[model samples]
Target: MLESYSRCWTEIDYAAIAHNVEEIQKLVGDTKIMGIVKANAYGHGDVECAKALQKVGVDFFGVSSVDEALHLRQNGIHDSILILGYTPPEHFHYLIEENIIQSLVSYDYAQKLDAYAKEAGTKIRCHCKVDTGMCRTGVIYQVQEKNMDQILAEYRMEHLIVEGIFSHFPVSDDLGQESAAFTKKQIELFEEVCDNLRKEGINPGIRHIQNSYGILNYGDLKMDYCRPGLLYMGVTSDDAIPIASKPDFIPILSWYANVSLVKWIQKGQSVSYGRHFIATKPTKVATVSVGYADGLHRLVSNCGLEVLIHGQKCPIIGNVCMDQCMVDVTQVDDVKEGDVVVLVGRQGDHRVTIDEISRKSHSINNETLSDIAGRVPRLRRREK
Candidate 1:
């Protein structure tokens, strides 16, 4: 059995991450890969995962903010990093000082960043973001003439070097006819904007429009780079429709906790805080050393959530508490305190996946993974 000094911990398979990178490489023949390490590699430990990715030849990284990018740079990552989201104008100097590329979200934002960079007597590298259809960020692509003028103004900024242009796909993962058509239009619009820039004697240094889903469903699109987040993490959302040619990616994260106490409960006795669960019969209950505070979602309590104990599925008996939760272990033979409990990993013939947890919690895989608190230590594992 695995033992941890902490209440719970996550085991990261570096080998599996490397294998997933290789699989992504196969799809994107010569194009560059921007390993999205934002949100601490989706709560898989950014620095460690970034180091593992660097070992596999991923030279470019995408982060959500300047802090995340700086975190990588400070941790000995010398690779090129682009902030895919907003960065305060006050931190524009940091981007230039750190040689980190900032995403030009809007023309106004660009002007503000340029002003800061100009005052600093330096130029900040940037990737122009076009709102093709996501309508979230970036300069709107619907107004082509106005959008072209705005992007041209950004490229013309002396203190801002627009080194690349990219956009997002809102529904590229959905292969249904309507959704697919909409995605196609988004790609076309992004390309058209890039082409327009080129026509104005401006070099849109690196043109990339593919995200994780875009890479999977439209891998044939010629682009200079592809940013993959969830795909690189080796798991997709439970609702994500899989393509026939989807590469085989190994899941890289496993969560485990130790059984803290074991006790038998009489019939009609409830457990935990709320009297939500009453023992129909004499049942054995084991309190796990993990709960909501440990990244175990309280929503999954009594919602068909189970943990593997003695290689058997034990049902969560009551409402999950902040620091602990109880699970019925009557069916498990010889289950006792100090036993290893598989919260989100394989145990014998059974495996509880992130997708399973997401489904039970009525959330997405990204939330389920990133919701894991920082208190849970992420230990790296290289499977042989």
Candidate 2:
């Protein structure tokens, strides 16, 4: 019997991740795959996923913040980890000390980091972000070209190493008119900058731009490296960008819990708080040890949500409480306590995908995964 320390736990499949990487490798061919382990590997568990990715020969690991990079480094992850977002000026010291690379988005940021590195008597590595179309970060490609050139030259003098130059696409996952047109323009602007720099003998170490969606859609326009975040975590983009051709992804996350209580309810009786679900007839209700506190969305409570219990699809009854939720298991014969109930992923012939839950909750799978509380331990499993 499968058991867990807590009734609610998130199971991660390292073997499935490896398989996903292998499948992506077949499609991308030589284009490098930068493992996107940001947001705790998109809530699948960061350090664990990083180690698994390392074993499979991933090119690089990209994180959202400096703290995330530090966690990986502290856990003996010596591979190159790029902080995709901003790092505070006060903590720039760790960047040099830990050999972590940062994305230099603005001239002021670059200047501050250069001075910080010099004061520490160490060189800092950074990638200049080109704001081709995405206005979120980086220098605007058109108006800031001259400014970028001067900054690059000044960086060399200040002993700041420009390890790479990259940009982000706003709508690389969408095939819609505006998204495609804008993405194409962004790609053009990004490439032109690289080409212009090289023409003037300015060689930015490594070039990369494509994200998970880009890898799926515009893969043929491969650059020096690509970032695979959601794909590596075993789910597609929320945008539902149609794929041209690629390997099928294996879902790497499975949320499970044990049945804590089971009892028969008489007709006209209600289950859980607020009397949300009233039984019209005799019903067997199995209470699961998972609730909103355990990353189960509150919206799912009192909603028509089903979980796999004893290889049977059981509908959730009443409102989901802080510690548990009740499910109708009357149809599931011989139902008892301690049965494994799957909230996400498959069990027997019945399956409840995270995508399904996301749709039901009117949210994305990534956001729902993030809601999974820290109390829910993520157990890594590799099926032999």
Strongest candidate by TM-score: 1
Model 2: pairs clashing at backbone N, Cα or C within 3 Å: none
For model 1 the TM-score comes to 0.96
Task: Quote the positional error of residue 236 for candidate 2 in Å.
Answer: 1.1
What is residue 14's positional error in candidate 1, in angstroms? 1.1
lDDT of 2 by residue, 280-369 (tens): 999999999999988888788767889998788988989999999999999998877878899987888888988767777889877887
Candidate 2, number of clashes: 0
The per-residue C-alpha lDDT of model 2 at residue 267 equals: 97
What is the lDDT, from 0 to 100, of the residue 85 in candidate 1? 95
| lDDT of each candidate versus the true structure | 0.86, 0.83
Candidate 2 regions off by >4 Å? 142-157, 239-241
Total clashes, candidate 1?
Answer: 0
